[model samples]
Target: MVIKSSMRRSVRILLVGDRGVGKTSLILSLVSEEFPEDVPSKAEEITIPADVTPEQVPTHIVDYSAAEQSEESLCEEMQRAHVICVVYSVDDEDTLDRVTTRWLPLVRDCCSDCRVPVILVGNKVDLVDYSTIDAVYAIMEDFPEVESCIECSAKTLKNISEMFYYAQKAVLHPTLPLYVIDQQDLTEGCKKALKRIFKICDVDNDGILNDAELNAFQRLCFNAPLQPQVLEDVKAVVQRNCPDGIAADGITLTGFLFLHCLFIQRGRNETTWTVLRKFGYNDSLQMSRDYLHPSIRIPAGCTTELSHKGHQFVSSLFERYDKDKDGALSPKEIDNLFSSCPAPLWGPDFHRTVTTNAHGWITLNGFICQWVLVTLLDLSRALEYFAYLGYNTSEKDNQLSAIQVTREKRLDLAKKQSSRNVYQCHVIGPQNSGKSMFCRSFIGHTLEKTFAPELAGNPQCTVNVVQVYGQEKYLVLRDIDVRNVSDPLLPAEVQCDVACLVYDVSNPKSFEYSARIYLKYFVESKIPVLIVANKNDQEEVSQEYLLQPSDFCSRHKLPPPHPFSASNKIKRDVFVKLATMAAFPRFHAAWILFYKTRHMKQLGFLRGDSVVWWKAGLGLAAATAIGLFVVKVLKTDKS
Candidate 1:
């Protein structure tokens, strides 16, 4: 489909020049389709309907005559006009000289801020026996705003219709933003936009557009596929002009840029503009605001996550960019993956924020987990990157299809089960409570690894994939620091899917901080709570609080504090337990049943109602047995 011009309702063309330059004759001839013997000082304004115009936009023609309108009125008209037609009598050399000295300067002074386009119209060409096209070309060079020069005869009606058409085209499909006439190349903005488009179309991340990729691009922009012969011809032309444009596999980025430059050089600005607008760029060579941040209303209590289609797209992207098939993206490969974006979405601390392999590269699971974190925290930014990454190429599909807005959190809690694949756990504790270490450990970082000079920054959040009941779920651990026990936690800090109250067991005063935080925040809320006594490798001290750690948990009817030590061997079982609690927030029995029945259902052991009832009874018995074992272990730790 043909992309329409920018969202302009109408185009206003104003005629300005010296007297007797046939400005009046041009308008009168266009309206009447014939030369008029008697012409007024200036013709009234004319409005052309959108259906009759090639641009499908309403056109308004205004006439300026020195004898009829004042200079102030002329300035006003110039400011209002989208494009100016500076008329000069082709046979009168003196009139053409006045064009640069008087008319062009006047436009520049009046419309300095707007930079309105100018169409140089040399009228009454019938009287000129010799060609003056060369002179007009020199004028265009001097005035960069001059879009095009047309020579016409108002009396014979020669090129009369074409003159106004050029004027309208100048305003709608402009070349100024896309081309540089003096340098004979594309403008920087145009090049940047096209480079992004090229990267998006390079599906394999090999920095080349193969035949299939090229055909997909054509179909996306023009709604038609290229014939095999035509595709080869395109490459042949590029190869002939640019030696390095073609690669062994397909057309390189250099070739793609050269093709666009060639199109603009051949006066095919519409061709380049078509591709740009189809990719969500406006006439200004910037992604349109509406396209970047489409209107998506997320009601209160709702959270956003990637839809199935979104997950599939990003997973495919990961597989494509993993050139070595090593199941992880190196630093260079990560750069190639986000080359189409304005900049890398993550920062130097990204490795600390997600699950990276021992090589310090982001693993596929970490990549997906990071995307899920962004969708939950900032949905608009996720949508913007989706546009940059070419997630939606067709007008029928949009970035909205890539996002899924969940029902209200209240509804999920009421149902006693969440359909979300991601859960956020806020780790709240006082300063130096080993909170950061606990959060980092969620992504597999040990105490020594967290202290690495490269991981020096204080990244408050970390995410990684965890298995709960044989299903993969992302768990985001946010390290929320409390300056003092007296300082209150913000409402946003108090809200989360799960709350982890961490305290340094070696610090005598640490247990009080965790206790106050839990009583202040999670005691009344439905959010699941987990108490962790960190730094267990050090000698355990009696907390200087009214109630010891075990007694505090018992009084609150919360689970016994889980012992942990970042200095000890890394353990993933604690993370799995936390994720399981998050998955089933309402009841402990449900967690046990979910974990126990997963394999049974997979094995088709619960196919009949009688078998399901029998299994459910077994599940309850097992849950009770596990509960007694956990209590026994807690009592042993307390003693």
Candidate 2:
């Protein structure tokens, strides 16, 4: 039994049994999850029990077993056992006979042949004959050491709770408080997430739930929801925060709550659960318990800090992996480094044409190697050679297959962080280069009409100013007002990462102006300005003005500038990628997943005309092969 309440006291429990008697199963069922050890492995939620009163302690049954124990050791096990469970099966006559012959001697060694409060568990009830249940109960009647042993089953749950009740009579108070906490202070997001947690466990969003949500969330997110006692401990606090007639229409949840509910509905990676299990931290429960106790005044603030740190760590890892100047690694390269699980050198899978058992199960060495691969990303650089296709294979074959199954989750998390974090970027070019037009595109308006039909020198000119933002509570694409200024504008006002100077590639004069501007802002002072030569469609802008990218970088004495087009075939998606990269430089790791998915999208476009071209090539090969086959047949016929 375990106890903790508004009263602030602690409860302790002890369980003891012979090893291999299904003790671990009972404890795992009670505390861990009912997750099956098969198929797309799950993370079942563990619910804390609702509170039991002071007089009635909350009964938490944990069945502990030691496989090898001496008589003295068995005696020591029962010292702290206020409630003992001498478990046996109704179907196993020999094991039942041993309850008197082999088992009670161990109990007697501990407590000198005295009767203890206990329940006789007839495990595997699903596999037993019901007729023997009475005979099993009769066996306990002769043993004074067995106080109230019922012939109950563990698997079919036959009288399981009743058995616990019998055991709890020696321990628990039946009328314990159901909830504890001041509900008024809960955040809407927390409340909403919690309500969904309740729905998952309770199976309906009826404002109260436990146990079942644990199972559902486990199936979906590969993570268990809150435990039952944990919910009970905070129930009052939830009610206070979600007061009646507050955001309810007659009764309705607020918009904020709706979004939070969406968060609950979100998917989770099945693979992550595998990794968590391997690490022995299968759920967030053990991790969050000591960190978020009621004694802490600002409980949520700590959680916020932790989340921020995790986001930063993820971003930092991304930055490290994006090796090429391009914002993202090609899918093949990423999968080589982070996508696949590595087999160990000790196994048959380690070398070419090796041994596996006739049964298809690997030897001990092979088994260990495969089992060690809990997650795909655990593969390091040394093992990358085996991941990609041979040189004969084309780039189209590349895939970050490790992430194919869970890319949605990884991308979702990255998006959340990018939206929340502030980063820097810039644009560059010269006069009449549509610099202002491009910048305005970020805010979704255009000065194209304002720049057209110039009357005088530098007519309708608006440049030399940077947009400074402290913090945007809204998205960047919102139509915000802009103010332009004269030359030598101080970027300190904007505090941006870089600046932009646009020049018309069609106009030689404009290109000259663009060059001079780059020298002033970036070349001399080295303040990082990106030069944009616009008007690629116009014949006036010659091909020479379109830098081979590398030469442009050389000429500018800076890294090559990523191309931007107000109009182009691939401009939209390319720009989105560039914009994401520029906005979040720390998003280095995500770039690989980004481009892999991008390239994967191309598979949908390989149809119609492309298919005809491939078919034509195939037809030629088939014709040649048929011609050779006819020649051989004619030769055979003549012979």
Candidate 3:
């Protein structure tokens, strides 16, 4: 069946360059498969049918004439375009110069927030006996967000199809560049090209991509299945860096971006260099002693620039080793660190040199100077050291209770002085339990009874998790169908803070499994679960498996089962209120503060080491007791 026009895929491509730069010629070549001797100098748009895509994708190409350079009209076109191609002729040096000086700035100004993908095209390669294509490609690398720079001949049809293919790829599967150059490094002509790309690959629109989404993306991009070996390698890198691990379903947006980088970087299977680079190590395995520090000992043949994060990482690592805070690592501390290092032996001579420098203790400067040489010689050992620093299979794969994991995350957020307001609530139930309708109504979708006949069919088509964002309370609702519980990419039961156990009040079997199976086996006590008895508006509500609030509260030891009817306003309001309170961030934050404060009070002296230590210690103790009382009450109710 033919897909609806609203669902038909399309991309608007804007062709821009200097006058007589083959912009019109190239368009004619792509559409008609022939080059016109006389190119019209009028601005026009043509829609070409792109049957190469999975469905028939309509591609609109706009050949922009230099005469229509009005600011108002240009901005309007740029806003509409999905991808912008800045064309330059290989034979014309002046036209290539205009690409950097004129075309790039205009594109960036109109599409900075829009984030429209850009391609730098060098056309008319057949005209030149020899070409400086490599030099142009190298120059294009300096331009940020230039997806790919390619030279194609419109007359010879060499790489012409490939050029438009890349244009489509840029629109369909755009990703941020792995490296970003500082603006100060570019000249005035190239100033507009320095804006970096933001890499967010949520192709499934679920706020995150799981294994299934990732696999789908691979198939769409490559027209082939992802190799099993490549999949494992990608997972290995993510497990090393992401604290949530594979069991957290897939990875976050940041993890997805890093995975994309790993795909492009050299040595695909080995992520040692990727790990070190992530933790502030430059390409040469060296960092400044401090952030923006003037004192930098740059080694020869080193191209890695100074990173601010690298300085912070080194300073924090050094502080951990230098407990005395004397600005150096003692022999005992060095030995202890080496014990955990992935490398078994540093060699007798190398160890002696690193341990005893000109100073009695090893300083940051001395440590970096020696480590650079070792990395240049034996890179394998450096990878081991990175693994020891927490990016390893052993540490990432280790299981932790939901409570402990949440507490650690809260502490990290506290350290960063921020709070996350968005919360994820997983909705689950057995087949035909009105779970989908409950989710639809909760997200404010209209629940007209006229559609009840359509909704009564077996609802097991949810192959991928469906996410709905709520307008109120800033909550995210994820519908994890019961059939997808075994899917590795779907979020685990423990990953969510709130459990929504939906069931049909008309179906006795639904209620039985909602309580005995889902509640008993899947939902954890730490998670606040709300049992929703749906379809209360039905004529015959089965009382055989249904119990009143007081009876159910006492029997299952859970909060009252919410008798929900999407059509009834009163029931809907009550259920929404209960769900909001359970998923609210403030409630979770309060518990986090209580637990962290209790732990801090035990430490006692981390607050200060002054004459008023006793006063400070006593004040903390008093606050801890109060928090403990509050926590105890809350714990008793399992809120």
Lowest-sum lDDT 10-residue window in model 3: 397-406
Candidate 3 or 2, higher TM-score: 3
C-alpha lDDT (0 to 100) for residue 204 of candidate 1:
75
lDDT of 3 by residue, 1-639 (tens): 110111226978888888877888888887778877777885468887767543257888887875866778878888788788888988888888887788787877887766666888989888888776666656556666676668898888888888887776666544332233342122221111111011112333334566666665555434465687777777778879665545456666556545544543332312332333323233223321221122223243221211223334344455655666677777776765554343433443332233233445666653542443333333444333433442222122211100010223344233321122234467777787767666555433346632655344333111111221232222335566555334333335445546777778777566666665454554444455667767778853454556643355445445456667776453344344334434332243232222233233323334434434455446645644554455568668974
Q: What shift in Å separates residue 590 of candidate 2 from its native position after superposition?
A: 26
Over 1-639, each residue of candidate 2 has an lDDT whose tens digit, in order, gives: 222111213222344544444444544444433522332122222223546422244444544434345556556656555556766655567766766787666665665543344456655566755655567546544653343456454445555556555555433221111111122133342443333232223223333333454334344444455565654433433445445412321112332243333332231122322322222221221212221121222221111111222223223323443455244433442342232122222222221111123433333322222212211212322122212111001112211221112222224234432332222344444445665455444422234422344212221111111111222211111111222323664554233323455556567556555455455555644233444556555655433345543355565554333345554332333224333433333332233332223223321122334544344435533543554466468669977
lDDT by residue for model 1 (408-430), tens: 77876765556677888898887
Q: Of the candidates shown, which would achieve the greatest TM-score relative to the real structure?
A: 1
TM-score computed on alpha carbons, candidate 2: 0.24
- What shift in Å separates residue 58 of candidate 1 from its native position after superposition? 1.6
What TM-score do all the candidates reach, one by one? Answer: 0.89, 0.24, 0.34
Cα miss at 166, model 2 (Å)? Answer: 30
Per model, how many backbone clashes are there? 0, 43, 0
Q: Whose lDDT is higher: candidate 1's or candidate 2's?
A: 1
Ranking by lDDT: 1, 3, 2
Residue 520 error for model 1, in Å? 1.6
Worst 10 residues of 2 by lDDT: 386-395
